[model samples]
Target: MPFPPKANGLFYNSLPPESIYNATPTALEQPFTPKMTVCEERQSLRKRYQFPEEPVDRYVAALSEMAPNCAFGPLENEMVRDQPIEGISSEGIRERLLSIPDFTLEKPLTASQQMEIAKKDAALFSIPDLTAAVQSTESTSFSSFRGTGDLLRPTPPCFRCGRASHLASCSNCHAKHARCRKRDKLGHFAQVCGSVKPSSQHEVVHSVSAVCFTDIRRYHIKTQC
Candidate 1:
């Protein structure tokens, strides 16, 4: 049946284009306020404490990531006051809070006791080991590039060509056209030089030649006759 004509012709029902619930007994009988789930409660809380889209305070962003972790920090007692969010009961929050690790400078025995006893003996509970830890508490070591002896320093780039090479120069640089020392000119090297005399120094030949054929012209005339 429609609403009274005097009131309106419009069907003022909800989602999916219908008032299917109007005739159903189950809908009318059910509780209007349903109990929220744990996730729903958490989401409600997140919306309530939503980080401003463009937050001016840097702490806001940091706090969002570490919100659950805040339970273990000093800030838990000061800045973050717990509010009653449904499904996050006092007992639940306390259990979560207890599980979070609190960093304190107390004796290491408490943490050691929580670990498997076999492993604890190696690092924490033994008097000797504990003493060693205490002694080395102030010791510090730094990470760095390995010592100069440990690494072979890369060779500086060749000046002739701006590239790295091992044997004083690169192959490209070595193959370049070098001036011929023999001819004092470029394009061809000294080994292939066309110079009439070799550029290298030579000893002066001082020994006299003993040639016995001084009548070469007379011998030629007798032969012709």
Candidate 2:
């Protein structure tokens, strides 16, 4: 068999050593490895040396000229006495015959034509008094609360309670993790989580101030002692 590729680590390991040793009676004897062919040796060298592939066939047109197109072509020509004439092409044949129209219409209607027909149909069914009906009377007026930013802004849920409110963080909730009820990522409820920024800076400042005040009071006590 040919030698394995370069990646196979055991290719050179299979070769038996030339050293001779006395065989023990208790030890199992190994069979001697036979000499490999020159082809196998060449194949082993290919793995170690990277050689570019060279095509075995340099020219194929010469071989093609020696052999006929088909085996039966010469045999079939024996019955024919005159030279063969070329037949008419499809374009020439179609030009000679009268064309028959296809039954189906590929395009039912153009985009503009369909749109115009739709507008006419809609107008026929539409109420003539629609404009007056949509308009507001002199006594009646419409007002929208949407214009107010504070009122229009969606209420965010409390971080602790998991309920929708105006608070930045949730309170009065017993949940272990104050994760958002909707996305489950934010510490606050989904409603307010988008708008509520954590007050970590304020809490940090308060803790620092408390620590400083306690240290000053302790120093005063130490001086009195």
Candidate 3:
């Protein structure tokens, strides 16, 4: 006896009988309705959609590809209009989108309009403000030049007595020197003083004389009174 006719496999027993095959078309055999297909496509596009870091035109193009047949209803249309404003990586571009004069909730901007504004805003953001840069550079250069000039400038001599390194009030000549006879002022020697009034009738003069006697017998003297 051949082992009591081998038992049917568990998988074979679990499968439906042959009658179920002709009961009705399986889900795979049923042709999907257009609405069902569109719904599935929308769900898939939503899941796969990503806001790229590319230019606004490319971003708009990507959105267009999401619903090529324009099958999205009013709500989805609103989403398509507003997504870039919310999802844009550039704060500047987002602000530009938000600031569109005619882009109210009731009257949303079209893709072409959004693309145009975004392109303009991106261009403006990319350009450097040469006037501001020039002003900043000039300010920095002036500050640096002023600092160096202060460092390199020569220290003036003391005005009172022609001394170096200190102002007249702070110099050693301030107290140590006698009053100038010419100016009748303190803190300076008469010979080295400045800013004194000149006399019209007679001028002050200083003289020095030296005499040496080598041979007394051959010497002659002269005098003026």
Candidate 4:
């Protein structure tokens, strides 16, 4: 006789996307081991339930109360925290949650609470677990490369500079200032104004000017020596 249609659950309606079975290689050239059973089990579990994303902080507290003798250390708390149950089964969840204590905030078992002298057990334990390495690999491979593409691409010219590059690095322009003049403007002193007329024009004369005849060779160096 065939099994009833409802033998499994809602996920059984359609044939699974991939063959549940697959071949595996053995150390020897033996025939491949069938993987259909394993694949189907994973698929069924994936379809049946979802795990909670929130930190199990409250659950942790409850567990501590319930399992005083069970000694879950900081590392254990972290191990539990880092685990992702996104598709865990309800039974699995029950197993996990029931493992914790059954304490709630309002009823802190007066006598038990009194005796428990609630010393804050710091939840700080650093076990260099593989999570960091896994996260680093994921970020560098998936996220960091995508992020870097934008940062390294050349940006449009700055609006302030109106040039094809960084405004701050533009040597062709200067910042607006109270005492500064624009490059094209002659609002400031003449470039030659600081020098005195030579004591004699002869000092200023060039060989090209035969008509110039002042005799003295020098005068005060200029406006401000």
TM-score, each model?
Answer: 0.14, 0.15, 0.36, 0.17
Score candidate 2 by lDDT. Answer: 0.37
Candidate 1 per-residue lDDT, tens place, 48-68, comes to 442323221232333345445
lDDT of 4 by residue, 85-182 (tens): 34232344434443446533222223223222332232223334665775576555544544554355443432333333543235543321112233
lDDT of 2 by residue, 143-206 (tens): 1211232244454444444455434333445432556777787444565554534464346446
Quantify all predictions' global Cα lDDT against the true fold: 0.37, 0.37, 0.53, 0.35
What is the total number of backbone clashes in candidate 4?
A: 6
Q: On residues 1-225, what C-alpha lDDT tens digit does candidate 3 reach at each position?
A: 432333435333444566645533543344463344776766655554335546555665566567654477656656566666765565655676777775643333354456657677877766678756866776666556555545654545555555656655673555346787877977666766654222211121111111112121123211110
2 or 3, greater by TM-score: 3
Sort order, lDDT high to low = 3, 1, 2, 4
* Model 3 lDDT, residue 195, Cα: 41
Query: CA lDDT of 170 in candidate 2?
Result: 36
lDDT of 4: 0.35
Better of 3 and 4 by TM-score: 3
Candidate 1 residue-wise lDDT at 56: 17
